[model samples]
Target: MKPGADRIELRGLKVRGYHGVFDFERRTGQDFVIDAVLELDLRPAAASDDVNDTVHYGELAERLAAVVSGEPVNLIETLAARLAEVCLADARVAAATVTVHKPQAPIPLEFADVAVVVRRTREESA
Candidate 1:
């Protein structure tokens, strides 16, 4: 971890998207729950008490939602990766972990949910 490294988390951000192998899934979009954890230095924000010193989570949420609602993908893994990219777009974010939940997955049996989690560093995203 870098100096003053702390975590900023956004959890349970739900958006409707068309991301799945099945044609029906794409035709009728489903909800995807997203969780993102960002690792970065928070001391600047703490000291200055300025929003500019830290990551603006509300804007981040909007960006992530746009990704989820925009293009269609065949896998949640791709979606998670895309979300990681969005999180790492900020230079302040050293690393990020993104999880995408597919609650209405096509399964033969009953299950709680299906999700994919991806972790990436700023370098990797770049």
Candidate 2:
């Protein structure tokens, strides 16, 4: 693949999660928005028009949701790293970028949102 061209993006994925250092934040929970872009060879899927030719996005999202909501973490960095790891677990995915958004943060000032984003590439072997 080229340096920066092809990608498969999953955007605005909403999930309820408990991730914070504060007890109230963990107990009450909040909505988290996730965006993921996967880089891979799309030629095979493009030619075949078969689900098997590419990574199953629906399944990936489901698993990601599970990971996002399953446990409580202190930082969005941790969440982003774990999600990236999960996405790269699929053999077909060569690289991925994950973003986790926190819209309703516990800050004093007003802002649109807070988030963590990460990009990762597959290991050399397999």
Candidate 3:
């Protein structure tokens, strides 16, 4: 978003999914955390005071969870991309920033988390 553009932020959305490379990781689903920042113009919603004028965040969350719990991808990057697609499907959204976190990643050493961030903006067709 630009310096003054309106935005909607969704954070710490956790879902269970089977998205990983290892066989064990796929067989046993793991917890995945997602964060999203949706950039858009909220003036319409603000003035109209109508839910339809703005993106419904509850529905958005459900759609994002469906993507995470749907197909199995080997990379969180791919998962993040799919999530961004869902976010950008709304024509009103100017940009979508998606972050996928994997806390229980199979690493030999102690690590806090592994995550992938993806940002996508609407493409204006001429």
Candidate 4:
């Protein structure tokens, strides 16, 4: 059960929070959808069925919400990077892909939303 042997997906996690540059944008936040895929080894957790043996997806979602909603960020890239960092912090999660969607982006033209995606892996040098 070495690292980077398992995968977990957290898809379409809808979070409403303040994240923008404009004053109005921060005042009246918008909905942000987050999708994440984590690579880890789940053999230990599988054998014991213990939460401690694996990464808790629910906790990961909450941490992402705190980051996305806690403060305002000018770009989704920053947000996505922050999320990637969070995922990599967990030793079990060898790598992660994070996507942040801003369905309420301000624009004159018609569109569904703007989004950013980032993939990160734990570095051996780190």
Stretches > 4 Å off in candidate 2: 124-126
Kindly indicate the candidate among 3 and 4 with the higher TM-score: 3
* Candidate 4 lDDT by residue in tens digits, 14-106: 988787778888898889999999989888899999999988999998998888877778888988998888888898788888999988888
Error of 1 at 122 (Å): 1.3
Better of 2 and 4 by lDDT: 2
The stretch of ten residues in a row with the least summed lDDT in candidate 2 is 1-10
For each candidate, give its TM-score against the true structure. Answer: 0.95, 0.93, 0.94, 0.88
lDDT of 2 by residue, 25-81 (tens): 899999999999988888888999998998888998998999889989989899999
lDDT of 3 by residue, 28-64 (tens): 9999999999999998999999999999999999999
Worst 10 residues of 3 by lDDT: 117-126
C-alpha RMSD by candidate, in order: 1.4, 1.8, 2.0, 2.1
Q: What is the C-alpha lDDT of each candidate?
A: 0.94, 0.88, 0.91, 0.86
List candidate 1 stretches off by more than 4 Å: 1-4
Pairs of residues at least 3 apart in sequence or in different chains that clash in candidate 2: none
Clashing pairs in 4: 6-40
* TM-score pick, better of 1 and 3: 1
Query: Relative to the unseen true structure, what is the C-alpha lDDT of residue 101 in candidate 2, on a scale of 0 to 100?
Result: 97
Q: Rank all candidate structures by their TM-score, best first, as comma-separated numbers.
A: 1, 3, 2, 4
Clashes per prediction? Answer: 0, 0, 0, 1
